[model samples]
Target chain A: MDLHQLWTIVSTPDNVPIVLLLFVVPFYAWYGLRQAFANDRLIAQLEGNPEMAKTHHRKIQPFKAGWTREVHVWPYLLRIEFLAAIIVTVILMVWSITLNAPLEEPSNPTLTMNPSKAPWYFLGLQEMLVYFDPWIAGVVMPSLIIVGLMVIPYIDANPLGNGYYTYKQRKFSILTFIFGFIVLWVSMIVIGTLIRGPGWMWFWPGTTWDHNRLIFEVNRDLPDLFGIAGRAGKIIFGAVVVGAYFLAAAVLIHKLITKTAFNRKIYARMSVLQYVTMQVFLIIMLSLPVKILARQLFRIKYVWVTPWFNI
Target chain B: MPETNGNDGKPAPPAAPAAGNGNGAGNGGKVAAVVAGAKAVKTRAVEEMKGAIKAPEKTDLWKSVLRVKHDETPRSRALGVLSNVFLHLHPAKVNRDAVAYNYTWGMGGMTFYVYITLVFTGTLLMFYYHPSKVVAFRDILYLDSDVPFGKLLRNMHRWGAHLMVIMVELHMFRVFLTGSYKKPREFNWVVGVLLLVLTLLLSFTGYLLPDDQLGFWAVTVGTNMARATPLLGHGGPFGPQMGMTPFNDVRFGLLGGSIVDSNALLRAYIWHCVAIPIIASAFMVVHFWRVRKDGGISGPAPVVLESEIKEPRKI
Candidate 1:
């Protein structure tokens, strides 16, 4: 194991945020989930004792008789805000003083940066380029992600867990979000930043980045794997395979959505349009991980390939 | 003469008599009269000054500026937030539990704070920076080696940007996890998503200002993706059939040319320094206003039990 190699990647000024992210994301995730589980416990308690539920102050936060429900923003909320701002300023000042921003040589278009990367945030999209065509990965996926996020409130018909964190209350929506954000978005960014090295090749953490390293693995398309040779036959085979995958995913998701009585109630609340939109987004989202698995495990390059585009 | 002055309704009887006796005694008496008058005036001035210092808020100037009393009373505290231009974004009061760091995580407020710092450092960086390729790199080098705190300035701007992006993502995550985007908050959430896009664009644009290899290559990789924007990009599917080309495509519009060149630098500079900030600020205004209009922070609200699930409202 090349400890120096790991340090080099981790300590690079630009990579620092991703390194920070590795810690920050998990910490916050645990922090949020802790509250969620706590609330879940409280929710279970309240459910069992309907008499107490009617009288109990529903929040896990401590409360007492004759206490004010609200407090002045001036000292209560504004003080915290002021303190937070001061803390942030100190952190930024310290960060700025210690670490200089990365500056490479002057622009020379003739000489290209090996494994040139988009900004760290866009690195997730850049990583997608490996599994899909540029149009789909770069353009379509990003547009869909933004649109899907915007439509979430309109689509989510579950009225429980509206103002508080509770894993049991919002199991489906919470899990779906965690999968999308932490798994797909953040994890991909981490992979793009740390694992993908020179020549955009995967290098395990602590492994030396060998610029000359090559993997002589054959990657095949789905149609080719199925022994389809003719142009028309290949196109038809790919279409059928992609269509089958979607249909299967839809069935599985539907089953999960209606599995519990609570889930069914939530599912029933969704209008037809909301249901369809949610399914389309979920299927598309699921395809990302499925495609990643296909490429990594089976060396499958494209599941569906056409004259103009490939997925 | 002092008694005669007293008859004229003068309250300073002691000072008047002393002055009158001094005047009768000639020039030395006149000096004594002046000294006595000065002593009385000083005592009265000190009393008035002490009263003013003790209750400055009662002064007309203070009242005009603050437009309200600022005592420890709850009414004054409420007015403290409601009366101010900046603090007015917030309501006079908030849910007691909402003020705790656990519920909100303070990410939204922190993100805004970081953005303010970015704008500050960015404005300073612009004073030393020129968008042209010829001097851009040299200017950065000059900033590092010569200009006072210029290196610090650039570093803060750069890191603060990355921090802002991180904070925005976290804020969104917290909002989602807490289910804070339900019902009336749905539109504000949409506004927030737009702001997120604008934040990314702002940072991406700023990446190229240094004209360094890191930025050049990163931007090259970025805009190259634009070239594959299906219908509009020249290299995208059906782009050729629809008359898209390298010279007249989405990528070309973004870069102001076929490649990342002088024009690209200028465009990035303009967008980074001017356009996107304005757009993001406009969205933020609506986002914050809606947060207030939609029933304040979405709570540490009383948890709803599963059995209490209301029937779906029929359209």
Candidate 2:
């Protein structure tokens, strides 16, 4: 193991945030789920006891009979805000003092950064370029992500978890979000930032980023593997494959959505428009992982290839 | 009563000692009267000054500046938030549990605080920076070595930006997990998503300001993606057929040139420093306002039981 190589990557100032992210994301996920499960237990209790349900405050937060339901913002909420601001300031000051921001030599067009990477936040999209074309990875995926996020509230017809954290009530939505955010978005960023190295090649942590490393693996398109020679025939074959994947994914998602009675109730409430929009976004989201697996397992470059575009 | 006092045309002093010399006595009496008048005035001034010190808040200047009496009373406490322009964004009171750190994680507020820090540090950095390719790299070097606290300023701005992005993502994650985006909050979530995009764009634009190889190549890789933006980019699918070229595509508009160069630096500077901030501020106003309007925060609210689930309203 090249401990020096691993240390060099981790010590890079720009990589610090990703290192922080690696810990922060999982800690928060666990923290949130802990609360979720607590609330779920409470929900189960309240569900079992109709007598307590009628009189209960319904919140897990302690509430005595005489306690005020609200508190003054002056010392209560504002103080927390003030404390948070001070804490953040201290953190920023210490960070700025300790680590100098990275600055390289004067920009020269003639000399390119071996593994030119975008900002850490956009690293996920950068990683997607390996699996899909730039048009899809860079342009279409980002736009779709923003739109999909915006459409979430409108599409989520489940009303049980409206104002609270509860796993039982929001299992489907929560799981879907975790898959999209933690599994796909954040993991891709982690890969792009830490794993992808010189020449945009995968270099596992502790492995030296060899500048001249080469792998003889050949990538082939699905059409080529199927022995389709004619251009029109390849295009037709690719279109069918992509369409079939979407169709199959949609069916699978439908089965998952209606697996339980409560889920079916929520699903039944969604309008046809909401349902379709949700399915389109879900299928598209699932496509990323499928494409990633395909490339990793089979070395497939593109499933669909045409003169105009390839997917 | 005396013959001399009548001749002088003066009133008698009740307790003044009579002087034998005529001109000397008259002058001494006049001086005594003046001294008495001064002592009385001094005593009155002392009393007034003591009163003022006792209740400075009751003074006109304090009342005018504060516009409210700040006392320990709950009314005054509520007014403390409602009356101040800066704190008025918050309600007078909040749900008791909302004050707890566990529920919201305070990420939203922290993110805003970091953004404010960035703005402050950015404005300071701008004083020492020029957006020309010729001087940009040199300015950074100068900032590092020459300008007082300049390296720290740049470091804070850079790190604060990264922090803001992380906080924004975390805030969104919290909101989603809590199902805070449901019902009336849907639109605010949309606004928030836009703010997220703006935050990323803001950070990306600032990356090019240093004009060093790190920033230059990072931006080149970033904008290179734009070159593959569907029909708008020159190299994108169907872009060539649409008459797009290196000189007349979306990327050209973004960088003000075909490549990352002097024009790109200037463009990034303008967008980073001027345009995007104004736009993001506008969205933030809407986002915060909607938060209050859409029912404060989505809870640590009492969990809604599945049995209590109401029928969904038909759209």
Candidate 3:
């Protein structure tokens, strides 16, 4: 984006965080992953090789001995935390002195600003309002995220990487979390902040919001695209599509993520019902990004819209 | 001893030992006398200086407060943390790996620090600020223009708050990446996530205190989103079917009325200045305590047990 656009985004209190998260998430993920991969290459290579793993483990055993020691928190952990606090205080002092917080005219109900926006952190949810109805965008997704976060410890079964960093052991979790936070969350914020203009119309970053600009977006769902007319026909067709999607995803995950022996062991460990529930959860979570993409790229909204609600 | 005269015509004390004494014995005696005389002169000088500059009496208050001693044994170090008021939040001992600068990156600590700053500055700002729409904006103007360094105080509080939100998010990110949230620390992780939510709530409530267009509109947008919340919201997708109304909805409860007005301002003021902070503070205490209870930040698996098992094999 050009400097004008950057300044416009930065000046807005809400958009500032979106810009910051967009930059920070990738840098941090890169840093964490880089450190993990660099140190855990041997661990990665030894995965799934039972015999070679034992030999490699023995080889590295001596070097790993001195990695950690118990030390007094008074001068170690507490001191560092205290120092960090002081540094932040100093930074805040400098920042506050340099930049005064924005305060516009008092609230006037008669006048509405163009692109009235939520705070930057919630911009992702605001952007989701484009693709999904308010209930799904504002209510369901947030509740799911919060509950999902709380339940992660119970759901994840791999027990190896508890007390240390290990990319090979926790690749699935790390990658999945990063994808959700960076791609789905932060990218949406960026889109909402920079691309969205007056009346929530899509605008390029360099362009200014123009009241006279005429924009039209026609969103066609599967039923409309396929010329399906009756409500019964649409309901049946929608159910089939949604069902087929989950079924295909479940089969693919089972076949692709595990070998025959591993698949059988997983199935034995978890009952059919539990396995199906887990697969369905994954399908729903993965579908969020796919739906967003459909809305953005193909102007497809409301894959299934009923009288009660739209999805 | 024999007496001798100096160039200034003053007689010196003693020039030489008696001729009757043995050479070695006499030399030793001369040396001893000289040494005694020198010591007396030094003592007199010290006494004179002591009189001129009185030495202050020592107190144990600082030493006791610091919980430190010259003899720093392992037990003393542990006691230092346990007994010290500030240090007691942390465990007596921590894994060295946990404190590694690159590992935790000190984000959690920084968040705590910023919150404290905000509390201090926010409390100060309250003295000059009134929550009424008319005075709220004027109060800010007064702080910036009339009150000396009022602008600085306001700026610090405002910026510290924004910084705190970012810090809390980063801290959670670090916790996730290191997998410190797993196992025994899972409860602490939940507490942390709750703290994150509270941080955002505090930020949101604080936004409306300025009563400016930016603050007002931001809150409007935020509470509008709340109105779309299912079941509890008047304008929610199922609000109509659920028999929800503007007077009884979640958004109304939050804003204290249908629209952003005096009630909304007062509600935000209470939430921002009092309610959310107290809740956040309680959660922060639990979060820190749980860290200690969970045996401190996660680090490398203890090698002692593994070494014990390997010791027998070597033999």
Candidate 4:
């Protein structure tokens, strides 16, 4: 879309939600990346010079007894906690008084709300239903995420960053999780909560969620978009694409990123079984944005479809 | 014993001699004596003020109510924590690093505080609320309009719930960024994640209690998501094919029927007020206890240079 179209979309009341969803990620990513880079540079400088490193360490270290007078909960932690609670309580009271919690008409199961939504936290999962089959999006994928998060500590062998927040010590894991959390989880939530309107259609922020404004577009698989005629051709093409992605990721991670001996040791320890599973999962996750872009830009959907599932 | 300063009750040096020639020296000494006498009186008053404000060490009215001591021994400190309900969750001593605002963002503490606020406000709301479908909405309306500070109570609970979720998520994010979930902390991290899920569940179930359009539809759509489970959900791919009826599906189990009805309301009520709270509280206890047992919240490893590694005293 041209700048004029973009500006019109943003200017329209109906497109307010769209504008918010579009803007949040790029802004946050830009900010987060700059901060991370600056931190990395500072840490590198400190580590390169021993005297400077000692000073930096001392600087970051919180006040010793003489400096800050740390105390027990009787006077310290409890006081801070209670003060925070009181402040929060006061703010909550003002908010509650000024803006009432929404209470709509009593539910009627017969008349489904035009654009039903889950709570904000689950909006990301709900939005995924647009790109994947329900079995994958709603059930298996969510289950995997919870399980994956719980298992991260066990699988990640890097031990240098257990106590600190240095990105350089744990770059891959930090970058990967950040991408998943922000781009996949948070961005999708913005879309589901704000942009989606009636019939699960996209609506801009200022626009009313009208059922009549639905845009019904045909979404086709990648093979279909490319005019691959037969089922066999599509399957072969899909397999080749999947294989190529995994191969490329494996080679890149191993060759380009795993330069240090510690990194190579960790990579070697991730036997083929572990490496392939993790790589495939990562690629599938990374492909979600690609699939979303394809659907939005080209109106292509179901890049891969089978009797049991579609992706 | 350290000499006490008459002016501040702190240790002070002995009074210096009045400096003067013989003629004025006697007057200067007299003036210094008067000033010292005034300082002594002020110090006595200050000591009394400090005593009055000091936390009670032993309450004869209820001995069990106060257990702390001004001069704590190892045994008394442990006993002080063990005897009190609130103090038991915390370790007697905390590392300075653990309490640093930037290290943990104080998010975990804020979450606990918010949770307590939710419980307090939620209980007050429960006193005014009735869980029936017909009266649920009316009860809320009455609470808002008719009851005294009822709106304030509901508002605090509502906003506090939202804040709790935000705090919990931020806490988890902080933990992730700091790599605080590694090593011996792995299980505590899992517990933390479970607590997060429980918190969301608590918020979700409570959402339906408001009985308005937002809660009703949100719950309806939220529960409907459960029906997409592959073989278990009645509306899922193989569910209908396998002859899975609506009554037997996961959604049905959640709502206690094929649709969101009275049973769903009661279930949400029970889950919100009793079941989830109990489970969450148990997990929270474990989470805190483990934090103490696991050597408190993680901090930066002590800096030791490569050359200093071999120097025993350098560390």
Q: Which segments of model 3 are wrong by more than 4 Å?
A: A1-3, A11-14, A42-68, A232-240, A252-281, B1-70, B302-315
lDDT of 1 by residue, B55-92 (tens): 88887888899998888999999988898999999999
Tell me each candidate's TM-score.
Answer: 0.95, 0.95, 0.82, 0.78
Residue A11 of model 3: what lDDT? 70
- Winner on TM-score between 1 and 3 is 1
Q: List the residue pairs that clash in candidate 3.
A: A14-A120
Q: DockQ of candidate 2?
A: 0.87
**lDDT for every model?**
0.91, 0.90, 0.72, 0.71
- Please, what's the RMSD in Å of model 4? 11.2
DockQ by candidate, in order = 0.89, 0.87, 0.42, 0.30
Candidate 3 residue lDDT tens string, B191-223: 888888889889889888888887788888888
Residue B115 of model 2 has an lDDT of 92
Interface RMSD of 3: 4.4
The count of backbone overlaps in candidate 4 is 13
Give candidate 1 regions above 4 Å deviation.
B1-48
Per-candidate count of clashing residue pairs (backbone under 3 Å)? 0, 0, 1, 13
How accurate locally is residue B160 in candidate 1, as Cα lDDT from 0 to 100? 98
**lDDT for position A298 in model 1:** 96
lDDT of 4 by residue, A1-311 (tens): 24554454345332333354456435544543444444566566666887777655432454453553334654456566678778877877777787566666877777777677777777788898887777777777878777777777766656556676656666788888888877688778777866776788887766655668756578778887788978778877777766776677667655634787656655655556656666656666766776678778998777665554455
* Least accurate 10 contiguous residues by lDDT in model 1 chain B: B1-10
